[model samples]
Target: MRNDVVRLGRLSGERSGDMMHFLSSMRADRYIAGADILVDIAHVLMLDRQKINDRATTRQLLPALLRLHDKGIPEEVFDDRFEDVHAGIESLLIESLGVEAGGRMHMGRSRNDEVVTCIRIRLREDLIAQMTALLKVREVLLTLSENHTESTMPGFTHLQHAQPTTLAHHLLAYEQAFSRDFDRLKEAYARVNQSPLGAAAFASTGYPIDREFTATLLGFDGLVTNTMDAVATRDFALETLADLTIMMANASRLCEELIFWSTSFVKFVIFDDAFCSTSSIMPQKKNPDTAEIMRAKSGSVFGAFSGALVTVKGLPMSYNRDLQELTPNIWRGMDDAGESLRLLADMLASASFDTKRMSEEAGKGFSTATELADSLVRSCGIPFRTAHNIVGRAVQKGDLSLATLEKAAGEVGGGISLAGKGLTQKDIDRMLEVRYSLELRKAPGGPAPEAVIAALGERRKQHHHDAELTRKKQAKLAKAKEHLIAEARRLVA
Candidate 1:
């Protein structure tokens, strides 16, 4: 029975069921199962359009395909006897409609062109979803930035407090990084949106096929052009995983910071209880397990990108069975990235900052020292390097008070007179204040409250622009899908 379905009596060889199952990709089969059905529908529709198949066969074919779509592919569609879902689906089609009608579906395409087109169709939607998730995260960041325009915190370098910056400023930095990620996915979307249908087994079909018509119905932007490259190329899959890795890397950095900020020693921020987990033994432990897991996912995504690149790197291509191994990487990587964005956005939207702790820590490491030096450069005639030396000595000497700073400044000579070349006590008091420290910054991109507010306005504009861009593409795809279904249903009606 199995050999009759899998191979004709014309071939004498038979494989053990164990070997068939071992070589089977049933686990990976479901990812493209729906894609296979859609590809078949589009190809059948195209064949009918080009007069390659009679109207009666197509009329029966379209409604039958839609019924299968409605009921969903059966569990037996993953049966190992067919080797993969593509063959399994064809067997199901043949079973449902019999040989004459079912056999015509494979006339002008191969599993090669069909699978690539399916991957593209599914991946296009996933990328849009990923961007949409990121946009939500970006909105959360913008809201956080707005609420904390003057909320001062210690900004760090090499894990040491380096300067005073607002929580708004720090969050905005991530907002911008993720904006670039949003942009990269948009860019990759353009390339991944092309169709590979009609590239039958690395050669153009002799049949008068309408590649563009199939592309339009499948929601693809255009065709993959060259018949050989269309089916053989895995770069689109590779490009998407690589793009996802970069996005995850950025998320991991934010997650790592959240882990540090939530630590008892820092106490700069606290995760929402829902996003945190308690230790198995320690009842008081509110660990940032969510962030840690997402952070670890960054490495896993990177591995996926690397694994795929190596798989396709040396293959002498038109198409190879080895390409089947690459599909799981794309599917798994996309799943990892999409979930990470959704969870990270949720985790951040409810997070709270310890303003007093952040403010207090902002001053402990002489973070306001730069503002003081800048004051010397402005209020006094001393050169910046001399002012730098004077302030550096004051920081090192632990003479952080108004009175002591005067004495320290007088003692640390750069051969420049301190009598008139440094700030007064009044100036010192203002410069030493963290809020005042933030207010003194007037540079366009500086961490000052007004500057952050201005930057926030600009980012909100960008957020709006990107959201519109996403909506436009989404509308295009939605229309294409509706058009495809409408056309198929039209023929049968």
Candidate 2:
């Protein structure tokens, strides 16, 4: 605490070491240091426009703040000697510009609203990066899907083969999952972009400050509206973490599949030597370390997300020190999810699926019985349950060969239904094949080669549109930052 400040005049400068350490915020505040300076610039500019301070003071403080922004605050500005960046910046300014000229910058704001404002500003950028990272992962997934449109693979349920699906169709599932996550981040950014700068410690300040002007200067979507809610609520923070958790969960699902695919028991996909690591002791051992670590990171993100929720669950209607604890989780969730997603894209780009092995596995586990049952219904006008029962009985006998199916159908009179028709054993043989099963089901979103190709075309279009949107959002931020700097320089001029 500054001994000269009127609010702390009752106390001496000799603060207890442990108490100062407990109250210190400079460590976490470093992440938002730039944001803190920007907040000061916006607020000082607003004060100058509103004439809240004498013209000379506002004029002097604006240039000083701009200078600090251009040439960053001294290291002492972020040193642990201060309680937080707010105090540290103020201390640095008072040291350089004298108290009367520099101190007026805080005339219309409090540290409570100021810190939250900085967090919102910085969090918005992080969320945009998160959205952008998801877009990159989406690109990788779509590329994998497009490349493998005709690549057959065993689609599993309960860890057993249930059907034959193309790799394209399977990869497209995660593309869609991650695409929703990208949308979630986009939505969260809207809330995070609202400005909290002028809320002034849960109430409006008496100073004739222009909240809208400050918001525009800061490139915020708009003011946060309610004074109390602006500083009190951390919902935007919580919502961002929720989006991150969902994204990580989606990535973890892919990681789990990658881990299984790289296993010796599966061998459905092979990782690049870079992505797989050899065991130290084992003569022949390859581990999917990237996938394993990526999968575990989702759990860590969840833990941080839950910790954030618990921290904010029962707080009163205002800022608290507890909110400080929530800030690190935002970085944790974003960093973990963002890096994990990038790693997933890289790991997948260099990986290749075992086309022949996947096809062979697709043939095992009676994967074609469903197709035979459907064929009987379509060609012989047999009810599906009856066909299913016949196939089930035959499957009990042995592998579903054409002879086996023919004898079983005859035993159940499906052959009788088909005997007079033009259907032949050749036709039945074609229907029972795994590739034929996939090729025949050309329904929308099916694993059929044609359907997957069409779906890939559509996903690629969506990905292109989304990627452009992400770029535009980043450009918007850059433009806002540029405008802010230009406006600051003009004010100081």
lDDT of each: 0.86, 0.84
Identify the candidate with maximal TM-score.
1
Candidate 2's residue-wise lDDT over 393-462, tens digit each? 7798886665676677678754554545456778877886888999987898999999988888888888
Candidate 1 Cα RMSD after full superposition onto the native fold (Å)? 1.9
- TM-scores for all candidates: the values are 0.95, 0.94
Q: Which residue segments of model 2 deviate by more than 4 Å? A: 1-7, 402-424
Q: Residue 377: error of model 2 in Å?
A: 0.6
Model 1: per-residue lDDT, tens digit, 1-493? 1223546645557778998887787778788888788888899999998999999889878888888777898888788877888778777777888879877888888888988888898898899999999999999999999998877889888988788999999999999999999999999999999998999999978999999999888888888999999988999889889889989999999999999999999998889899988989998888899999999999889988998999999988699988888888898899999999999999999899999888888876888888888877887767887778788877888765655656666777544555554556777878777877788786898999889999999999999999999999999988987787788888999
Cα error of candidate 2 at position 472, Å:
1.9
Give me the displacement of residue 248 in model 1, in angstroms: 0.7
Q: Evaluate residue 406 in candidate 2 and report its C-alpha lDDT on the 0 to 100 scale.
A: 63
Q: Which candidate is the best by lDDT?
A: 1
